[model samples]
Target: MMLASSCRRFYADGSLAPWGVLLAILDIWALVNIFGKPWDLSKKLIWAAIVFFFPFGGLILYYLFGRNSS
Candidate 1:
């Protein structure tokens, strides 16, 4: 309930701009990659590429293109 209210407040307040939200999410993604379960070399390399080259853009792309669940 608290989490849900906070998320509602977030959208209502507009304190979190889209880019800022994207940055926060990307930062979390990088952290998750660093700490989460181990992956195969290729998968780790892919995540490293996303984390290093253009973490923000990569995250935005993932959100837009890869996260559309039906």
Candidate 2:
């Protein structure tokens, strides 16, 4: 009952949540950049998996280390 009420508030007026939308956009951007690099197939797959599994932390780690790695 409490969970349902909170969910309704989150999706009030059929509008999406702001932070959720921003996070999704950021994640997609990370995925695109991840696949665009000329990285080895195995490495690419590993990064992609990390982003998929841990979207927020993955973006941070990718920008910090993965982007500069060749």
Candidate 3:
């Protein structure tokens, strides 16, 4: 509910849809990579929760800290 409403506001008559789409794609990519990492299940779950709950910021955090982190 809140997510949809916030996305609608972001669209701004569809002009911002591409940015949303890119973020969604990045989130998916992040999830897939997190799952594939050799880290423990608990660590993966923690990172997954972060990326799931906060998309853009999470992506940044993942790339900055999660990536290359075993």
Candidate 4:
């Protein structure tokens, strides 16, 4: 009964959390810059800013301030 209940609970939530996905993406981005290839200066600066001020405001700030249209 316990095993069945646990199985049902696990399957009840079939969606991945956005925050976890975002963190994973961020980890990959950091890993790429650290272990794979160096990023351009401007892009690196933007990434630093995003990591420094995390959660949501940093994203808004990056989109508004750091992103270059060209």
Candidate 1 regions exceeding 4 Å error are 1-25, 62-70
Q: Which regions of candidate 4 deviate over 4 angstroms?
A: 1-16, 23-47
lDDT of each: 0.51, 0.74, 0.79, 0.46
Q: All candidates: CA RMSD in angstroms?
A: 9.8, 6.2, 3.1, 10.6
Sort by lDDT, best first: what order?
3, 2, 1, 4
- 10 residues in a row with least lDDT, candidate 4: 1-10
Candidates 2 and 3 compared: the better one by TM-score is 3
Q: Candidate 3: give the clashing pairs.
A: none
Cα lDDT over the full model 2: 0.74
lDDT of 3 by residue, 1-70 (tens): 2134334436556565766767777888999999999999999999998888888778899999998986
Better candidate number, 1 or 4, judged by lDDT: 1
Better of 1 and 2 by TM-score: 2
Question: Which tens-of-lDDT digit does each residue in 1-70 have in candidate 1?
Answer: 2112223334556565565565666656664654353655666556555544555665555456433422
Task: List, in order, the clash count of every candidate structure.
Answer: 0, 0, 0, 0
**TM-score between model 4 and native:** 0.33
Best by TM-score: 3
* Cα distance off (Å), candidate 3, residue 3: 6.5
TM-score versus the correct structure, for each prediction: 0.37, 0.75, 0.80, 0.33
Q: lDDT of model 3 at residue 37? A: 91
